[model samples]
Target: MFFGSRKGSEHNSGQDKVISMDRFRDGSSLSPIRQAEAYWTALRQGEDVPKRSQIDPRGLENILSQTFILERIAPGIARFRLAGQKLNEMAGMEVRGMPLTAFFTPTARKQVSAALEHMFDAPAVVELSLQTEATRNRPSQEARMLLMPLRSDLGDVSRALGVFVSEGNSMKTSQRFNVTATELRPVTPLLKPKMSPASKSPNEVNAGFAETQAKFSDEPSVMDEARALVEASRQSMDEARKSLSEIGKPTEKTKPSRSSHLRLVVSRD
Candidate 1:
């Protein structure tokens, strides 16, 4: 399927710095996930996350079963949490004590290497189609995989987390996420009369550059920009927060529709 659903994750290894505690304590409007989101915002912005090895597996185990299949895929690879016996069997046999390279057929192995490398190279989520044992060695029935990086507090790439989402005949749609934002020089054509530093002089061209330079001086550093980009992600994540709120709202006894069953996955890179 060309179109697929979007997935997300939260990094809660560190203290809950990013979350809003007030609303949560009173159990007013904000939910646990929302409060946890604050922690996630800080994590995304480069706050130190405890090493996974240092983390209590049991502490996260309950969250894992509720979310993804949380076993290590290889030396530095982990699969997004998956459910059911099939996933467990696959992990048990080849992925646990092995490098991910072991699972791919030789030709596919090369591709897997490249894909995993790409995940390490960037902090964005990547999607691809892959063959699985469940496919019966046939060409069709491929599982869609999304590779995301999990990082350490030092801002180094830690583990690459991937999700193998199955797509049947139905259509799939994947939402695009902005992992990083670059500082770009403004070009005239795309320019609108947005707010700029106050500078009025006869020579407009030189004045514009001078003003831009000054603005940059007062603006965020590269590190701060990184923080903003991560904080900005909260806007995108608000959708999930809203869903959780609706779920928590008291209502007549009824199971929510699959319309709300949309699954969102995130590889903490």
Candidate 2:
């Protein structure tokens, strides 16, 4: 479920040197947003909300720095359990223990909070279109945010997995994103996967039959090899007895040879 990308490098004058901009793509074209969406979807498998344990950092290596995790502390409130480097760069500080709404502009804070509540309640995925504030030196920058519900170790819907990415230069200072647009997609756990008989493989179908046959088959085959060996042994013993009986019985004896009395008497002399 990994998306392929063609990466190109960009040189900056700041401390961040040799920045690699990877262009991820689906079947259509390169898109980091689509890559994030696909990654989130794969993590869920068939469940509505993926368990926090199911997440592996290596799986999202392409977007590792862009990912973060939030712990829902109360209703309509979530604090960061983990924040990635990309997010910290945007905030210009350590974001751990900070509210998720802290990254949003003041005007968009309420809407973003409401959306966070919906994400936990519906256990759905939320995608946000964000814009950074405009200033004389720094212009307005656009970004995308993806939030998906995650189940905590206590089996509560209080955790969320998220990814945030901006399509501009890295922010040197704290930047708040204004939620210009938001999309909420409802998701439900696949209750029962369709058990299609037509799709069953031959090995799978025979596995049950094999166990059943092994259980009910009590009759053992006759040992033909033993019988054949016993028969051959009996035949050999009969032939031996015949030869012994023949040897014991009287027969026409052959005459002794005339040369039997001859000997070399003076051989050693």
Best candidate (score: lDDT) = 2
- Candidate 1 lDDT tens digits, 91-208: 4432333455454455565555555555555434445555544333333345444444455556565554333334332322221111121121111122245655454433334543
Candidate 2 local lDDT, 142-202, one digit each (tens)? 9999898889889988898888887645656888889999999987765667767556644
TM-score of 1: 0.33
lDDT of 1 at 24: 50
- Model 1 misses residue 177 by how many Å? 26
Q: What is the lDDT, from 0 to 100, of the residue 51 in candidate 1?
A: 31
> Which numbered prediction scores highest in TM-score against the true structure?
2
TM per candidate comes to 0.33, 0.60
* Model 1 regions more than 4 Å off: 1-86, 91-94, 132-139, 167-269
